[model samples]
Target: MQVMKFDMCYICLACFCIYVSGCERSNNRQIAGEVEGERIYLDEVDGMITNSLYEYLFAISETRIIAANELINLKVLKIEAGSRRISVDSLLSMEMRRISMQETKLKYIRDNALQGGVVDERNPFKLHPLDTPAGAEILNNSYQKFLRIRLVDELRVKYRARILLSRPQPPQVDLTNVTSHARGNLKALHSVTIVSDFDCPVCREAYPELSKLFERYSDHVRFEAISLSSSVTPPILFAECAAKQQKFWEVYGYLYGQKGYDFNIDSLIAQFELNREECKSCLESRDQHKIIETDMNRLRQVGIEVTPTVLIDHRVYHGPLTDKAIGRFLDDLFKETPNPGN
Candidate 1:
């Protein structure tokens, strides 16, 4: 797994929300961008444009940084027959700024616990204990109030820098173009939607059952897997690339077909009959990268938090996507209304 230089801002947001609200909530919002870059090539696999993590990072750098320094690397992509250029520092800075804002918000709420009677609107901090008057008396101490105010002020300044730095520059355009090939596939399906990550154990485990389910109901199912790699690589977009080659089902079969399997890039890429050059090129292309970000933004809009999150019959499933569970849910739905689809 490639260790990302930037702190995972999502984790920071989670911590901040938990501290402030005393409730478990997540903050994984998607920011969008428009591309004014050169006309590029994209591989159409399995009726969809292929995307990958490598591509997304590239796109972000292009939009964020005016110039790519020596630290930035440019590599030729085989799939699109294009060069992918990116700045490491710029990407790291973007992620860090995101984390900083979250941390600052958490600190602000903590600081204004109850000093001077001005409390934070989202107070997660506890007031003085009240088992007896002595505990309540301690709350009246001026020293404690002073300490809290000082702490809040200091932390706020630190986090404000982060918020400013990570703030997303305006997106030039929103990338949500579904290729003609992809549209055709959608028309064939009773429903077209994105599934959860490949790295998720549940996703791996659910692979065979999902394949079987899709096969049995091919007349009504159009399934697209969202590649949520625990690693930095964009596994989902790679899967999309395979789909363009009309190999999505085949690749999906090979991937989910194996039980308790661990998939790596080399192993998975080797299995494809795709034009290695084009697949590689598209996987690293700037446009494809932007598309993946758009997809992620769409997923976030629908409030997806975990992998193996499925949208069957327009209903979102966040829990385990098991055979019995799904079957029971589907069966019950059909039972309640014999013609739910209609």
Candidate 2:
């Protein structure tokens, strides 16, 4: 009978109002209309529905809902395990370590291979091309799959674990009007949209990870970067101007990779061999500033408060980014569709 409550401070009032209206319209549904006098059973345990939880559920998008469900499932499972004298925390820690080890191994192999060229004999980390028969064999191995299956089988046998809740489909987001710097196939089925600010340190750190994703999944996922920064406007303006000359990505890389907050635009112009006059004119004109403002407003409307937020298949993830996290998100999205690259 132990229940978890939702924290309302994280959610906005506007979203709550919308949820309330939706609930009023869905009066015929059992758990949709009101939080009181409603319960959701998980393994014969009653999860009391509270108004805060209901508002939180209705306020957030599908990704957040699925994440919340997962948290609820974990809580229920832990309670169930306690009744059976099982150590759920130990089991979870073990499972996490197993997954982490597999990921580390794969990352090491991939990083070495992608570095390319002469093997640095001194560097034990050096790897061969992934296309090589040896590298290909290792990359194609199903050790991770075997480990996961084994873990799942053991857990199910021991705990009689089952997932009764179904994951809802992620909501679709319209990106037609958003100004973005894009890389990868335009028609790719999976779309990753990043709302980042040039002045944000976290965004700078995320830039490389985002680039890595574009490089790895360009054939399957369309990647777009939208600029939004409240700290500094010049860098974003420079990026937009550079986009006009078909050099957004080039300028973007430099801006993100630069060591300091104060960057030399002239050096970048010279380094990229951009038309100095045109770039300067574009910067001074401030026409592209409106585009950044529009992008900012659009993100705000959708309830995003942080920079370096990534929307992959409409599931929002904030950063500091990691390859494993991005990979897992893509894997989940790919699992639901037959043609992942569609």
Taking all chains together, each candidate's TM-score versus the true structure is: 0.40, 0.56
lDDT tens digits, residue span 77-139, model 2: 576567767688666556746765755645754654543532323554756455687555544
Candidate 2, residue 67: the lDDT equals 68
Top-lDDT structure, candidate number: 2
For each candidate, what is the lDDT? Answer: 0.46, 0.63
**Where does candidate 2 clash, by residue pair?**
none
Give stretches of model 2 more than 4 Å off. 1-171, 318-320, 338-342
Q: Summing lDDT over every window of 10 consecutive residues in candidate 2, give the lowest-scoring window.
A: 42-51
Summarize candidate 1's per-residue lDDT along 1-342 as a digit string, tens digits: 112423353345435434433321325322223358533222112112112231343244433332331112121111112222335344334434555565453363366463323312245353444344643455434333444344434444543411111212211222134321222235342342445565567777777776565555455444545544333345567777777678776766666656645656566677675788788887878887776666666655444445665554444543235665555444444444444353
The clash tally of candidate 2 reads: 0
